[model samples]
Target chain A: MWKWLHPYAKGEATYRLLGAWLPWLAGSALVTLTVGLVWGMLFAPSDYQQGDSYRIIFIHVPSAMFSMGAYTAMAITALIALVWQIRTAEWAIAAIAPVGAVLTFIALFTGAVWGKPMWGTWWEWDARLTSQLILLFLYIGVLALYYAFTDARTGAKAASVLALVGVVNVPIIHFSVYWWNSLHQGATITKFEKPSMAPEMLIPLLISILGFALLTGALVCQRLRNEILKQEIHRPWVHAQLGVAEQER
Target chain B: MAFDSWYDFIDMGGYGFYVWLAYGVTLLALTILVMHGLRTRKQLQQQAVQQQQRQQRLARRKQQERGTA
Candidate 1:
């Protein structure tokens, strides 16, 4: 089972894999985001109550969703690094943390912007919002820990532990609204039953979510390739790769 | 089709400021992230290229010294 993944455990192989996928990830992200944004902003019907302010949901929900998604991915990568002692997986954690942090910030900022119109406040210490804030801090913490040590391996181990511990917050962030009295609304797409949103609105929201996910993948690949280069700069492979790039240029 | 005109769409039914602000900020953040990733990759690639050049120069100097010896 895991044997098939053995080849990719090598840094060069993993780097090549990511390079192969980056174009597809970026291309699809662009296509889906354009379709979703244009449709959601220009064609999706207004909410009966919130009017067009509800349109902010197009970005807010997706960013909020993917922020958690990125953290979960980081935590899993951390697990692989710590348990299997995989260098590639360790590098993956560093690649993921910044993107997760940025997405978390986007989610919080969009939520605050949307909150002003719906909840009549820029922010609140509600369960959902607070947990999400904590998630952002957790990402920053992981990043800070990863760089705090001069020994890269020691730093990676510390960051991996932090990432694992912080993952409990992901579920808490997702379920906070239902678990506590909160100004934030409950689930839309993740519900057990059909999503509450109309098909017209829900369709675009789903597309936007995919677009964000693809963008995250592309960004992570970009960072991971950089990490590999930084780690392998002295290797003959790195020299050869750079030589090829130079010749092309 | 939700809005009848360009102004109506931009206005976003009187909630234009909030909607546009949210979109604008999200775009800005993502753009920053993408730009930063691109810049970092380029810098690292440059560093690798420079290291390669230095190694080649060292090899060339060693060859010349060996020939003279």
Candidate 2:
């Protein structure tokens, strides 16, 4: 399996792969986000209990959910790099960290803002909120560790170890509401049997989620290409790629 | 659709501050992130081109020195 996948792990191959997919991701993100946000803000009916405040769910829930998803994704890339010694996967770790960190920040900030009206406070120490805060710290910690060493390869390994350990927190973040008494609401969209939201409310939320996921994908691909160029700048393939870019310019 | 008029939608049933703030902050953060990533890539690509051009100049100079010798 390693041998077969090894060729595609090279920097040039990965660069081409990302370039090919960038347009599709960007287009989908734009379309889905426009439709979803418009539908959410103007079309979806207000919740009986929360009224218009519930509309924040469209942005808040997607960022909150994707932050966890991004962390899990970064960790999986780290694991692949560790186990298979793939350099592209290592670059992917760096590419994903900042994006995940920002998503986590958005989630935390939006949650706090939403909390003021809903919970009557800007902050809390509930298990879910605390765990989510810790998740943000975990992302910053990985990025910090990755850049700490002057030698990037060593830093990548160090960061990969941290990401793997942080994987424990991902599951903790997901189940914290279930495992303890918390002010944060329980899972709504992920409840397979029946989502707590009405279909009109749920559809826009789901669309926003898809839009956010595509946006994440587009950002990661852009970063990954940048990383590859930075690391592979001296390679012949990189020079050839640059030659084409120069001509096109 | 839920609002009776434009003012009512903006009023958000008296929760406009909380809802708008959340959406606004999220949009601002995401925009900042994407822009930063793009700017970094642009800088790196420009640097790569400059470095390549410098290396080529040095190689050409060395060849001329060899020919003179």
Candidate 3:
């Protein structure tokens, strides 16, 4: 496994790996998001309680879901970089942070939009809402810290430690509704039990979730590939492939 | 299917503001992420190519100078 993983840990190999997977991720994301969101808003039956407003669930839930997911992913990458001492992993931390920050922003934006009618307010200080807001700050902090230092290595080290520490908030965000009597609703789909929603409503949401996941994968892969190119531009392999640097003399 | 007509669909059963707002914000954010990533990647790729060219130019200059010497 070490031998298998070591090669891919190199910038070029990882770039190729990401390139190979990019198409599948993009294709699946395109198909799923189109089908899921369209059908969700148009064809899926309206909810008994929230009516058409509940259709927002298609975006809100998925964005919120991925916000936490991206954080966890970043934390894992930080762990990999720290433990394995991999430059690619550190680059991945930089690549992942921006996307994660954007996803967190999406989650917060959609959540606020969803809240206005349901909770009768655009903003709330409830546990679930508050913790999720904090998650956004943590993401911003990661990005900010990443660019704070003159040396990227130093910046990444600081960001990695922050990401590792911020992971504790992920669970708090997840279980906050359960932990407190919050205005936000409790979990719709938990692992241990059946989903609370009907098939028509649940199916579209599940599809949207998959779509969002695929989109995230595609974006991350593309970002990683770009980071590899930028970081490894001076490497012999990169120069050899370009064939422009060595010939210009 | 959920609405009686196009207007009703747009109205989103009177929650149009909230529903559309949520979807709109989500889509806008997605678009921003995509555009930003693409633009940054392109710029980085361009920078990489330019740097490579500069390196090659310097290398050739040195080799030519050495050959002449």
Measured against the true structure, the TM-scores of the candidates, in listed sequence, are 0.96, 0.95, 0.95
Best by DockQ: 1
Interface RMSD of 2: 1.5
Better of 1 and 3 by DockQ: 1
Every candidate's DockQ is 0.82, 0.71, 0.69
lDDT of 1 by residue, A1-249 (tens): 679999898889998899899999999999999999999999899999999999999899888898999999999999999999999999999999999999999999999988998899999998999999999999999999999999999999999999999999999998898899999888998647988889999999999999999999999998999899899998878878766344321
True contacts kept of each: 0.85, 0.70, 0.73
Ranked by TM-score, the better of candidates 1 and 3 is: 1
Clashes of each: 0, 0, 2
Alpha-carbon deviation at A239 in model 2, angstroms: 3.6
> Candidate 3 A-chain TM?
0.95
| Backbone clashes in model 2, listed as residue pairs | none
lDDT of 2 by residue, A12-102 (tens): 8889989999999989999999999999999999999988998988888988888999999999999998998889989999999999988
What lDDT does model 3 reach?
0.86
At residue A212, candidate 3 shows an lDDT of: 90
Off by over 4 Å in 2: A1-4, A243-249
- lDDT (Cα, 0-100) at A197 in candidate 3: 94
